[model samples]
Target: MEIVNFTPVPALIGGALIGLSAAFLLWSQGRIAGISGIVGGLTKPVRGDLAWRAVFLIGLVLGGVLYRVLGFGVGVDHIQPVVSPTLLVLAGLLVGVGATIGAGCTSGHGICGLARRSPRSLVATLSFMGSGLVTVFVVRQLMGVGA
Candidate 1:
């Protein structure tokens, strides 16, 4: 339960930006900013629907790069991996499967769906948070992997 870096101001700003971007996407394009859906759409290209998805994904990557270049958040030197590449890859695959099964990722369910007062989103978000908490407990407390 120890916090390594607790920069509330930067965290707040970053969260606000995410919210704003999600809101803008919903307002402007009548779309939810669900990254998994966006990426999934890219995999099975459709007519007239490619541009915004590509741009959104690109913006995500470029936003991180811009943040790093501007030195606004945690630096590269401060980032230390707590897991092996293989484990990371496996975890990513699990997440992808979960997103597919659940119908949307956190951005879509937690942010956009919750904003719209959707019951399914509430359940999905709760499940996501509960699973995350259990995973952290198992990894840090039981396995002593990250500790």
Candidate 2:
């Protein structure tokens, strides 16, 4: 296995921000700020829920814009995976559907759910992580992909 030159600082900073945002959302809004729920609200929204979801999403975009303007330049040149665009899109769709069916995504289940000390969330997170590890092993080791 090749060593990865990952910089921990950026990851730590990102994790802190994510933790803060989740905590704030739970404290202020009395809601979990799951991205899927926020986006789903855009489609079939309740009366009071729509406005905040819209605001949250808009704030997300505005936050990105502000970061860029303030010279926190975005990382554009991400490493590419060895998969076709079509396959990636399909996989994303499947994951989205699975998350919806499973009641939450990794951010919601792994971060916020575990924060609340929910057993179901812990199981879901472990399953998700295990599946991801197995998938990566199969793809990189067995299939010789994305090397």
lDDT string, candidate 2, 1-147, tens digits: 666978899889988898899999999989897787677777776887688888998998987787678776656335465698987998889888878777788888999999889999899899889998998899888988766
**Model 1 over residues 9-125: C-alpha lDDT tens digits?**
978988899999999998999999989889888887899999999999999999988977898566666787789899899899999999988988989999889999999999999
Q: After superposition, how far is residue 127 of candidate 2 from its true place, in Å?
A: 1.0
Highest lDDT scorer = 1
Q: Give each model a TM-score.
A: 0.90, 0.85
Which runs in model 1 stand beyond 4 Å of their true positions? Answer: 1-4
- Among all windows of 10 consecutive residues in model 1, the one with the lowest summed lDDT is 72-81
Q: Point out where model 2 deviates above 4 Å.
A: 77-82
